[model samples]
Target: MQGNKIFIEERLNDGPGKMRCRINFRFYMLLLSAVYFTMLYIFHGNLQSETQKPDRNKLSMGVEMQNAFLKIQPPIDIKRKVLASHQEFVEITASRLHVQQVFTTSGAKRNDIEVENSIISTKRTSQMIQKTSECFLPAVTPNRTFQTIEPTFYVYSAYLDRRYNDRFVRIMALLSLNKGNRQLKVSCSFRNSSGSIVETTANFYELCENHGRMYGGFILSCPIPNSDVCHVNVSLQIKPVHRNYVVPETVQVRLPVTQLGWQEFPDQTSGQHENHGQHATFDMPYNFSICVPPLFGDIDVMRFVEFLELNRILGFQHFIFYVSTIKNPDMYKILDHYKKMGIVTIIEWALPSNIRSGQIWYNGQLSAHNDCLYRAMSLTQYLAIIDLDEFIVPHNGEITLTNLIPKLFDDKVCGLSFNSAFYDKKFSKSTSTSRLLTARHTGRSAIFSKVRTKVLIKPSKIFEVGIHHISKPAAEDFKVDKVDTSVAYLHHYRDCVPNYGMKCKDFVEDNTLLNTTSQLEDNISSVLKLVFKERKKQE
Candidate 1:
C-alpha cells in the first residue's frame, strides 16, 4: 500500500512539469511568429518606399502633364471614332480626368463626385497659372512708341559698331531740329543682362547737319563699358543746349540693340589690329542685296514684278522692301510669295502718326534707308539703295552687277554713283509694244548726269546712307567713285518732269533693259503662277 502511494505522487508531479514545458514551448513559438511577421512587414515597406521615391531629374509638373497628355491623347482619326460612340467617349473622358487628377493632385480622401469636381478645379487653376505666367515674366521691351507730340526724337535701332579701334554702340534716331537748336547734349543709358544700368555722355552726329532741315537722321555714339555683356538695352536722353527751339528739354527713347560686324563671321574675334581693306576676308551670306525705300501708294504689280525679276537676273541675291502702306492685295501677295521663296523680306515701316504729316520724304525715307543700311550691313557684301522705278543697268557687256562692280570699281571705291538716265513714260516708242514696261519704254533721255543719281555701296565701308548718296563713309580713304555712262547707269523711269531743266521730248533709243527681257518674262510667269497657286491652296 505504501509503494503504490509514492508512485502516484511522482506521476502527478511529472504530469504538472510536462504541462508547464508544453506551455513554455507554445509561448516561444508565438514570439518567433510575431518577430518574423514584423521583419517581413518592414522589408516590404522599405521596397515600396524605394520604388515610390521621386527622381532627382524629374521635369516640372506642367511639362510632365503636357508629355503625359500627348502620350495618351488619341490621334484625329481615333478621336473621331471615339466621338462617334457617346458611351466610349464618356468613359475615355472619365479615364483622362482620372489620369489628370493623378498627375495634378496629392493623396486625399474624396467621394467620386468630389474627385471629379476637384479635377475640374485643378485643371482650371493650372490653366490660369500658365496664362498668367507670360504676363508676369520680365522680357526685353521692344523699341516702339505711340506717343504723338511729347518727344522730339524717334529712336530707331541700336548697333554695336566695332568698325573702328574704339568699339562703341551707335544709336540711330531722327531728331526734330530747328534753327534755334544749335547744340545738343546726348546721353546714353545702357542696361546689361544682369539688370545693371550704366550712363555715359554720347557724341551726337546729325547726318544731314548742313542741310538745315527741320528733321534729319542722327547717330549717337557711346563707348561700351562692359565688353562681357553680349546684349544691352540702350536709351538716349537728348537735351538741347538752346531751349529756345521747338524741341523738348529732354527726350528719352529706348531702342533694341543689335551687334554688328560679328554677324558676318561669328567665329572671328573683333578688336583685331586689322585695316579697313581686310573687311573682304569675311564671307557674306549674300553677294548683293537691294534696299527699296518705304513703298507707299498704289504700286503697279507688273512693274514691280519686272523690277524684281530684272534685278534677280542681274545677280541680286536678296531684296529688302520697307512697306509703309500697300493698298493692293495682289502686291502684298506677290511680296509674301517672294518672302516665302527666301528672295525678299518685307519690313513693316509705318511712321509715327505725328511725323507722317511733316515727315522728311515718303514717311521718313532717310531713317528707313539707314535702317536698311545697318540691317544689311553684316548680311551682304554690297547693298544697292534704290527706288522701285530705278534700275542699275550694266552697259559694258557685263550682264550682272556682281560681275560689273568688281571690274569697274577698286577696293578703295566704297560707292559707285550711277548717273541718272531718265526714261520718260510718255515717250514710249511706237515700235515697242511689249507688255513689259522696260520693253515698252525703249526711249530714254539723252541727258545723263549725277544730279538726282543713285548709288551702289559696299555696306561695310559706308556708315550713314542718304537717298541719293552715302552721307558718311566708314573710313576716310573709302570714297564714292562716279561710274562713266559707258560702263553702267541708273535707268530712272518716271513721268515727264521738265522741272529739272531736262526736256523729255528729246529721248534716245536705249534698249539696255531689254537685254534680260526674255528671262525676266519667264521668271515673272513662273512666280505669278506659284503665288496664285499657293493663294488658292490657302483659300
Candidate 2:
C-alpha cells in the first residue's frame, strides 16, 4: 500500500507539464474487410478443400489455433509508414522517459534547446492520456475558470503498463532557446547530458502503449528545438490501477477475516499448507457458480453477501447455489441484488451424499467428452463451474475487461483453469455483532500468476466441482487455458472475510458444519476481529 502511495504522488507532480507535448499518433487499424482479405491470403490454396466463404462469427470460432507468436505479416502497401519513428533501444526502463513541452502561448518555446553537437542519442519514456470525457460544455467549474474557445481534441488511447501506471514520473527535455526576442518561430536541437547532439527540429512526439502486461513506449521529436526554453521538466505520480474486473484486497482498509488455516503460508515449515494463492484475479462480470452442500448457516450467508457487494465494481453475474439447508432464509437475502437482477439460479440435492458424489463424478466424466460411454448419460452444459469466491480475469491485456473478453472469445477457447489466490482472517476493525458490521479488507498481496475462469464445456464435463482442496485423490494434471488476463481474474473474498472464529465459536457450541479444531480456534481468536467503527469511517 505504501509503495502504491509513493507511485501515485510522483505521477501527480509531472503529469501536467507534459500533457500537451505528446506525439500525434498514427494508428494502423485493420478493418474487418482487411482481416477477411488476410484470411483469404492464408487459405487461398486450400479453398478446393473447403465448401464456403469465411464464417460471420470468425472472432468467436477458433483464433487460438492460429498461433499469435508468429512474426507479424508485412504491410499490404509499401507506401504506408509509421507516423513517428521510435527509438530502437534504451539503457534501462528509466531512460526511455523524457519530456516535450508545448506552452499554451508564449514569447518562450521549447525548440531552442542544445546539449552538445556530438550528443546524438539517449533513451526516453512517455505517457499517452486518453481523454474520456469533455469538460467545456459545463456543469460546474470554479468562477476563475472561464470557458474559452479552443480547438477540441480527444485522447483516443493511452499506452502505459500497469508496472508504471502510478509511479513517480520525471522528464528532462533539453530545450535550446534561440534569441531573436519578439514574436518568432524558432527551430532547435536537443542533446544528451554528455553533449552529443541528440535531435533537431520541433515536432516532438510522446508514445505510451500498454500492450497487456508487457508494455511499449517511445518519444519522437521532429519539428525543431531552441536553447532559451531548451529544457522542459515534466512529471506525475500515477496511482496503481487494477484493470481487471476482479478487485484485490488491500491492507489500507479494514476487513472481516475468516480464520481457517492456523498458520499463514510461506511463514511455516513442516505443516505448511500452500496458500490459496495471491496471484489469481477476479475481474468484474466474471461468473461465479458453486454447488453448496445443504446445512449452511448465517455466517456463510453474510460473508458471501459482503464479498458480492465489494466486487460489484468489477461486474459479477451468474450464481448457482445448491442449498445444503432448505431453510436458509439468510442465504436467500444474501443474493437479493442478484435475485432482483434475475441472474441467480438455485438447485436442490434430492439424493444422499454418496449418491450425489457418484452423480457428480459421472457428470464430470460425461461433460469432458473423454469416453464414448458417458456421452449418452450427460445432462448439463456448464461454460464453467467454479467456486463462489474464485473469479477469473486475464493476466495481461491492453483493453479493459469489456474489450479484453471479446478478444479472448475471438480466440474461441473454452474453459479457463486458475488457482486460488488466498487471503486470511487478520485483525481488522469489524465485529459481526456491531450495529453496522465492518472489517479490514485485505485482498491480494501481489499477483505473479494468472488463472482461467470462463471455459467452453458442458456442465456434465465435471461431475463434482468445488475449490480444489488438496485432500482429493490425485488426478491427471490438466493445464488451464492461457489467455491475456490483464482484466479477467478471480478474487476469493469469502475465503478471507468473515470472523470465522466467533461464528465458529457459536457454531461449534451449537454443533453445526465441520468441527473447529483447537488450531483453528487459536488462529481465529488471536487474529480475527470485528472492527466496525474503523470500517464505518472508511466505507
Candidate 3:
C-alpha cells in the first residue's frame, strides 16, 4: 500500500504525464471516427452510382425542362372587375328579346340569319320570378360578322348570396379601348320599375386566366331595391388611346332579369312555342334531338359512326352538329350521309378570320349552341347538349332515353343534370369480335373514376347557356336537379395522354363490374350488328 501511494505521488508530481495520457486517448477516438466515416462514405457513393446508372435512361429530360420552365415563369395576377356600387332593377322587353345584328365596316361577314321565335314572351307581373325572354348579343363577333351595338368589352356575372334568398348582382364588362389606354370613366344607368333612373359608375379590375375564357372586365356591384330596370346603358367618357374616333361609343343593351340570372328557366320548350297545331303535316316526328357543338380536332371516324348508330338504338330521333372550319374528312363524309338522310342537320360555324384560337366567350359555338337549342325547341320535346365523347347512360333497365326520362323527370324540373363519370384509357377491356375493325375500336372502359356534370333541359326555361351548367339563377319554382347516379349519368371518356391509343392498360376481368344493363359495350354491340347487316344487304 505504502509503495503504491508513493507511485501515485510521483505521477501527480509529473503534471505533463497525466495530460499526455488524456491527449493520446482523444487522438485515438478521433482517428477511429474518421476511418469509420470514410468507409461509410465510400460504400454510399458506390451504391448510389450503381442505382443512378440504371435509372438514367428512365429519367425524363422533357419533364425536367417543363418543371424548370414553370418554376422560373411569373404567374398572372387575376381579379374580377366590379361594375356597380349600388343595385337597380331593369325590365327586359319580352318581344325584343331577339339578338340585334350590328354591321361593322371592317368585317366582311354579315349575320343575316335571324333565329325567330326564340324568345318566349310573357306579361310582366310582380309574382313572376323567372320570365322567359331573349338576352344579350355577344360583343366580340367573328372578324367578318356584323358587329352588334353592344360594347365589344363584354361583362357577365353569376353570384348568389347565401345569407339572403335574393342573389347579389355583379356585372362584368370588357372595354375596347386603344392600346395602353388603361384608365377610363364608365357609367351604367337604367330605368327602374318605380320609374326612377338608377345610375352608378363601374370600377374595373383585370382578372387572371384561371377565370376561364371570359376576358377580364370592369366590374360593378351595388345594392338596389328589388325592382326591374328596363334598359342598361354603358358609356366610356374618355379620349382614344391612339385612333381618331368621332366619339367613344356608348354601348347599350336591354336588361332582362333572366340575363342577370335572377331566376331559373326551362332548357327546352314543350312544343308550345311554335304554331304546331295549325300545320297538319307537322306530325311529332321526333322525341329527343341531340345538339352537339361543331367538331374540332382529328376525331376518329369509326368512333363517331359508332356514336350515331348507338344513339339511334337508344331512341334519340334527331341530331344537330355545328361543323367548324377544320374537321376530319372521313367524319364529315359520314355526317354528310346522315344529313342527306334528314336525320342530321349540319350548321357551318364559319369562325371569323381574326379570332384567336382556344375556348373563349367569343367562340361562335356559344351562338351555335343557343341557335340549335331554339331551333330544336319546336322540333323535339327535349334537347340535350352533350359532347362527342359523352354518353348519357341510364341506370334503370329502360332501354331508350324517352322511356327512362319520363319516369324520372317532370315539367317542374328546369334541367335534368347528369353527373359526368370519367373513363380512363388505362382500364379498357378487350371485346371478342371477329371483325378487324370492330376489334380495333372495342376497347373503351365501362368503369369510371370522377364525375363532372351535363344537363338536359327544356329550351323555354333556359335563359342562358353555359359550358356545363346554366348561367341563369334558380328560383323557387324552377331549379336544376342532380339525378342520382343510380338513375342515370354521363360516361365521359377522356384521354390518359394527348391522343392516347384506344386500348386500355388494365383490363377488367369481370364483365359484369359495371352492374348496369346500358353498358357501352352492349350498346356498341347492338349498333354494330345492325350496321353490319345493313352493309351486307347493300353489297
Question: Among these predicted structures, which one has the highest TM-score?
Answer: 1
lDDT of 1 by residue, 74-135 (tens): 35334334333533332343345545434322232223543454355334323322322121
Runs with alpha carbons beyond 4 Å of true place in candidate 1: 1-150, 179-184, 191-196, 209-213, 226-231, 234-254, 262-282, 499-501
Tens digit of per-residue lDDT, candidate 3, span 237-341: 555565544444655543322232213233323343232112211222345778888677788766786566556546565688877755565565566455534
- Candidate lDDT (C-alpha), each: 0.64, 0.26, 0.47
User: Number of the top candidate by lDDT?
Assistant: 1
**Which residue ranges in model 3 land beyond 4 Å of their true spot?**
1-285, 359-367, 434-451, 473-476, 496-539
Model 2, 273-335: lDDT tens digits are: 244112211111122222322223344544454333322212233344444343555455444
On lDDT, who's better, 1 or 2? 1
Q: Quote model 2's TM-score.
A: 0.27
